[model samples]
Target: MKLDILAIGAHPDDVELSCAGTLIKETTKGKRVGVVDLTQGELGTRGNAETRTEEARQAAEIMGLAMRQNLKFRDGFFQNDEAHQLEIIKLIRKYQPEIVFCNAIHDRHIDHSKGSQLVGDACFLSGLRKIETIDDSKSQEVWRPKHVYHYIQWYDITPDVVVDISGYINQKVEAVKAYKTQFFDPTNKEPKTPISSQNFLDSVTYRARDLGRIIGVDHAEGFTVERYAAVDSIFDLI
Candidate 1:
């Protein structure tokens, strides 16, 4: 199905951690939003692949996503070669989204930056008519999303734009909590990691709040853009 906005992450909970608030806010406005995870996060310290998949499904429902898919690329080892780019290109064409949200340009995890460039390159290549691709044996048309934005993840990159998600913070929190195995959970009996700490869980909300404070809003999500963000009038800046 055609999507208004498509959010792509290197792993399962990456989208929830960074852009869930924006996705929730968009869906509330009657937009068709979808998610594409490049990896299953199989290399995570705590949860296994099967459990992560189930958690992602629950999170999708919580966010009211129109579509949710996992590319199943190797968690930390996926490369940005032709093979990988082609896979991402197929999704870009299939969804034909107007806006695309991808992994942070720079982050603590190596996969984040790699996934950013992979998706960015794929979005561009997907628009080339000669790059032939097919789905279900039928030739697919080329498509390019109008905008590609990178959401902040593990790093505090300066944002090109900040989206006010005041009313959707609760939904974002709930969607993130769906991944009970990945985040802080005292009873999981799983080995603790950097993200498994209560401090990290609190950072998600505090980060949003911090961004919101800078923009005079209750809550907000930050994103870095490929180019200068412009609007038809000065009134567009809030």
Candidate 2:
């Protein structure tokens, strides 16, 4: 099915932590939104790959997503090579989403930056008519999203645009909390990690609040653009 927006993350919960608010807001408008996880977060200290997969499923349900898929790329070691690009390109052709939200340009995790560049490259290469790809049994057509944006996570990168998700903040928080093993869980006696902390968990919601405060909204999610975001009329921006 054609998607209005497709959000991709290096790890299962990356999209929830960074851009769930924006995604929840979109789905409420009856937009066809989907997610593609490049990795299952197999290397995380707290949860196993199986657990991460289940969490992703629950999170997708909370966000009202149209579909979710995992490419099963190597968790901390995936590369920005032709093989990986072709995989992402196939999905781009299959769904033909108008916009894509990808990992930040720079982040604490090496995979985040790698994923950001990889996805950006895939989006560009997907537009080239000569780059052949196949889906199911039939050859797929060349397709490229019109806009690609990078969602801010871990590191506080300045945003080119901030989406006001005031009314959707509660649902956003719920979607993020679905990843019980990945985030702040007092009962999860497995081990402590950067994200398992209560403060880190709070950051997801607080970060949205902080961004929202700057723009006079109750909640917001920020994204950096590949190029200038355009509006036919200046009033449309408001």
Candidate 3:
């Protein structure tokens, strides 16, 4: 199904932790939003691929996503090449979302930057008619998103755009907590990891609030763009 916005991530929880508030805000306004995870996060220390998939489903339900799919790319070894780009291109053509959200341009995780470039390239190539792609053995039409935004992750980067998510931060928190195995859990006997700490879990909320305060909002999500965002009038921005 066509989507108004598509959020792509290197792993399952990336989108939720960074931009689920924006997704929730959009969905509440009757917009169709979807998610594409590049990997199952099988390589994570705390959860296996199977558990991560289930958690992703739960998060999707909480976020009210219209569709959620994984590309099954290798967790840490996926390359940014034609093969990878084609995979992303197929989904872009299928969804035809006007706006696309992807991983940060650069991050601590190698996969995040790789997935960022892969999705960005796919967005541009998907618009080329000569780049033939097929779905279900039938020829697919070329499609490209109008805008591609890279959401902040694990780093403090200046944002080109920030969306006010004042009333929807709780939804973001709930959606993130849906991945119970990946976040802080006193009952989890698994070995501790970078993201399994109480501080890490709390950072999610505090980060949003910090960004919000910069823009006179209660909560917000920040993103970087490939190009300057145009506005019709100065008053169009809040």
Candidate 4:
């Protein structure tokens, strides 16, 4: 199925923490959205890979995503190489999304930056007819998304665009909390990680509020673009 947007991340909950509000907003406007996680997050401090996978599924349901898939790449060691690019390329062609949202260009986690570049590169390569891919015993056609935007993660990067997600912030929180094995939960007896702190959970809300304050909105999500973004009219900018 053709998707309006495909949000990809290095780990399962990355998209939920960073851009699920934007996805929720878009989908509410009748846009079809999907999510692709590059890794299962086996190396995360709090949860096992199997638990993370279940969490991802729960989050997908909460977000009402059209599709959710994991590439099963090594948690901390995946590279932005040909093999990795090819895997992403196949998904791009299969989904044929118009816009792709990926992990931040740089982040605290090494895999986030690598996955960002890997997916970005694959988006470009997917358009080349020479770089062939196959699906379901049939040769797939080349398909490139019109744009790619990287959502801000651990480090706040200046965004070329900010999406107003004030009304959907609660949905984003719910989606992130679906990963019960990862986030701040006092009830759970698991060892605490960086994300398991109450402050980290608060940051998710505060970060969006901060971004929104900059743009005169109640809450917002930030994104950096690789190339110039165009609009039909200046009034489109808010």
Cand. 3 TM to true fold: 0.99
- Candidates' C-alpha lDDT: 0.95, 0.94, 0.95, 0.94
Write down the worst ten-residue block by lDDT for model 4: 185-194
TM-score, one value per model: 0.98, 0.98, 0.99, 0.98
Q: Residue 158 deviation, candidate 4, in Å?
A: 1.1
For model 3, name the residue pairs that clash. none
Measured with C-alpha atoms, the lDDT of residue 49 in candidate 2 is 95
- List RMSD in Å for every model shown: 0.8, 0.7, 0.7, 0.9
**Which residue segments of model 1 deviate by more than 4 Å?**
none
How does candidate 2 score on lDDT?
A: 0.94
Candidate 2 residue pairs in clash (backbone atoms < 3 Å): none
Q: How many clashing pairs does model 3 include?
A: 0
- List residue ranges in candidate 2 displaced over 4 A: none
Q: Please give the lDDT score at residue 173 for candidate 1.
A: 91
Write model 2 residue lDDT over 156-228, tens digit each, in one string: 9999999999999889889888999888887888979988898988887888899999999898999999999
Q: What TM-score would candidate 4 get against the native?
A: 0.98
Q: Could you give candidate 1's per-residue lDDT for residues 69-93 as a string of tens digits?
A: 9999999999999999999999989
lDDT of 4 by residue, 1-238 (tens): 9999999999999999999999999888889999999889998888799999999999998899989999999989999999999999999999999999999999998898998899999999999999988999899999999999999999979999999998999999999999998988899898888899999999999999999999998999999999989999999876
